[model samples]
Target chain A: MTESLQGARVVIGSIGDDIHVVGITILGHALRNAGAEVIQLGIQTPVEEFVATAVAEDADAVFVSSSNGHAAIFCDGVRGLMAAAGADDVLLYVGGNLANTAAADWSEVEARFLAMGFDRAYPSRTQPAQAISDLVADLAQRRSASNG
Target chain B: MADNVTNERLTDDAFHAQRETIFREQLGRAPYDLDEALAFSLENAKRGTVAAVLQKAKATGVAAVVPRAGVASWEGQRALMQMLDEAGAAYLPITIDSLTRELQFAEAERRLASSTTEVSALNGYPIVAHGIEANRRLIQSFDKPVIVRANAVDLRITAETGLASGGTAFVSGPMYATLEYSKNTPLSEGISKWQYIFRLMGIYSEAGVPMADDAVGFSQSGTCSVPALMHVGVILDALIMASQGVKHIMLYSMLQGNIAQDVASCLAVEQLATEYLHKLGLDDVSTYVASSDWNGAFPERRPDAYGLIAANVFAAAIARAPLNYVKTIDEGIGVPTAESNADSIRVTRYLMNLIGRQAHAWRTPEIEFELHLNLIQARAILDAIIDLGDGDPVVGSIKGIGTGILDIPFSPNIHVKGNVLPIRDASGAVRFLDHGALPIPAEALEMERERLSHRSADPSALGYQDVVDDLQFLELDTFDPATGTEVKA
Candidate 1:
């Protein structure tokens, strides 16, 4: 497949009090392999930092990860921050254990993120390649819609 | 004075009574009978208790090889254990699944049942979710000492289930569990909970049931070079276990890729642990060194990873750790197959036997020098902790960690300052780039600084990128020590 994500810059990190860096690092490697320039903020990044970095870099998307099961609490104000920063057009993605309860429904988690202004929400077990492919498609769609 | 003494006695009595009540209530939640549990464990035990296995190792001068392996279903776990046992594993491990580790029994139960059809449904054997009878069946299926391995901070219930169901040992220590696994857990709370687990072990010991407690070691700190920091963690845990009257304690250390440093660290841990326990007035507590093969990041290539594993196992064998925890060749790839697990055990056992036979010829001046340096550095860290606690290592550990006096680099725990950073010296031994608030002695600090200064002229360049590079150093063909840059093959 072609490097569809060529020249695209994506900002990724673990949000809030979550300090899981391995998953983000792995994802960063995968994204880079898929030809996306990944700016990894490492772990325990606040929502505002992600927005600020995305705006500063004029990034294509903001990818967030959380493994401490407090994603909802940590990612609550991200959409608002983006809107206030006037960067609401940036595509936002989140994945990993998104709630404290292990048995929380995935559909509910996705809906919660959607309501919080995330463009897409992946499950903890979603493959990095799959996430990157979807992000590429979504970015293409957003670009076409904006041009239209 | 009499009134004050009476009031203090009343408070102590009340606290003990409440604690006893809580313990009873927790125990009552499950259908656990100590006698029945002991009978089940004894019947299922093929290689006797963990203590017996270690004793055998000591008497025979051969290290016991234990491989970490578990699957979701009882049958899968049994198959895995049977493979390792047949391959000559002296001890077996029943690693708990993430769900069971988090105390989510229902999910673990569902996954355990589903794992029968879909083998990949769960990552480990959920001992608690499977209940006592299933655990008994799994244990009875194997003839080796089976230890329950989990990141259990509050392991009272887990320990009860594990011991009652034929697990002779459980892997965890308060500081290691709290700081390594549970990022938000308070060290004090973790210690109190572990005290209950230790009390349970003491009860079993009193009843003539052999039990062992393995403290989580510097293995959790990854590749960062802090032998003293890791040794102090082991000693602190040993002291806690001794305080709870644990008879057998295993002070574990991981292979940090340097033979002299790893050997020195292991020897120092055993020496210091024994001395510290003796000083604490716990002369009956027996301690042994249990070395784990390379707990750091592994190379992606299977051949390279196997080579690294073999090297680490050789180091552990040469170190003469009574118990050696072996990791499979497929560690970097993901969960290893049962055959790979068995292969790892066989390889480690062969190497250990070779080393044991050549024990008399295995003396080196370099090892002696490293050992002396490790002992001094470890003693300095431990002495500082004791001073911090006002003669109590336990109290001092809590205060030391709380105030960043004893810091672990790259710890996920928010409470940990994480300001301490470790970088490798010219010879690839770990040394602190930034000591942070570690209360190490001035001489030890100077020695570490001097060692690092020899590696790089610009020590200020040692920061986040250095750690990232060091974590993946094994994967690179050649690593530039000065810049921490990797040249791919």
Candidate 2:
């Protein structure tokens, strides 16, 4: 277990109409404090902007957050956008209060997001900082291995 | 699997131990069994019965309302609106989602604009999206105050959105840091996230805007040692964290099967928690009674009319809580019908207007009634707190206090009953404390209606099955032979 997040380029932002930001901000601060080069995309960013920012900055991870129950939509669009931008290999993380509609099977929800290429999916009320740090560290290790 | 189980247990114990540390460190005591603490509180309540929290809300000009968001179908929103309308309660309707694809927020806004219904837009749900400009624009589009829900996992978004939209308020939940606490995740990670959410809360509060911090969705269901106590602690911490500018923390208590041994048990927990908050110098914190009695009386069956009637009575018992925004009975059964919703309100209103006064002494320390209900629980939990030295109720962390047991357990359906992991280990021998009855289904309503409407007094009463058979045969034969074979499978 190495501290790979140090200087890792990570882009944190919210996608789609889901504008819940507290979780993301927390993640950003944690990542920054962990010594990551973070591009905080803020809330309600279009998919194109995220992809552009990631591509332009050559970021290691694309973290997306949403609080409204439609995490599936957020995950799907971000996955699609990442694919379109050929940044599909970037570590994709999705989280938020994604399912408050009917009582839902969140495991299935998590699987669905995973299938959409997210490395992880967080339930709403989940801690985002941990995920950000984990994603950064994992990506940094991978990057180091590939370059080393 | 066994290793995983053991590992999980270890994790949970660690979580509990950690929680106990926080409780002891902050509140300076060990956890008390919920029943005991609640008992203490009830004893105190008997000595003095305060006016219903709603009376205070009415008198104080402070409002505690839940922003209900409907599904894209808009039915939830509509139902919420109708309930508010009938209750004569003004509320905020915010559109929030964890998923925003397919939804054109602009289009939704446009449609919302067209409707004659009164609705003010807030950031809506999770508020987690990268559309910074879009989110900002959405918030800016609404002239009314917008609430920004922030947590450790989402502080970056909060800061950005706060800067962009000038966040007027914030809603923070306490379960966030414990995401990994109950899970197999590393302990360090959970601690860091916990610290992170706290930091975010501080930021939002220090920013000078009011925050409606949530106490605990964690205590009743998750990794925390004493869910209820921890929830109370978190809320108290949140109030203190707010450092004065914070408007009102919404204290939420759902009637899970386990929180209160009965309805009185439920109310006892409520009263004790509320009193605890009051003691914490958080006089401004408002409470809302969203009794998740979604499970009617029967845990095994659908909505029971009797259970519903009982829930109304229970609601009346803890009227002393800061806010009582009771959920309609039809919630657990299915989507509540408009008539059912009205019936629920009428029943609750009737209870409030009728028996509520005579029941004023309902919180008396001792449980005179053999039956346990919300009020009894309220009294009992209060007693538990008193036993814990009657110290101020700590909000965020439930480390040592036994009153933590008083936390309202959420429906098992949301936690363990469904696909979600069970809160406790299966092998662990635990007391099967009868919390209370859960709700039944809406179909039961039809069955009851049929039983009542078509029943006969004689031995040859037209039973429901008999009526269904008659209807089936009639449909099969068709009223007219010309319509024969028209009934497809």
Candidates' TM-scores?
Answer: 0.79, 0.40
Q: After superposition, how far is residue B293 of candidate 1 from its true place, in Å?
A: 1.3
Please name the candidate that would achieve the greatest lDDT relative to the true structure.
1
Instruction: Output the worst ten-in-a-row residue range by lDDT, candidate 2 chain B.
Output: B424-433
Query: How does model 2 fare in lDDT?
Result: 0.42
Off by over 4 Å in 2: A1-148, B1-67, B72-89, B93-95, B99-172, B176-209, B217-247, B256-313, B316-318, B325-330, B333-355, B361-489
Q: Can you write out model 1's per-residue Cα lDDT over B233-334, one digit (the tens) per residue?
A: 888877887777678988888787777777777777888888888877889987778888776666656677677777777677777889888877766545
Reference contact recovery of candidate 1 = 0.02
Taking the tens digit of each residue's C-alpha lDDT, what string does model 2 give over A1-148? 4344676788877666554443565577667767789998766667788889999999888888765444544456777777788887788777765553324566876887888778888754354446755776577678798999
Quote the lDDT for A124 in model 2. Answer: 49
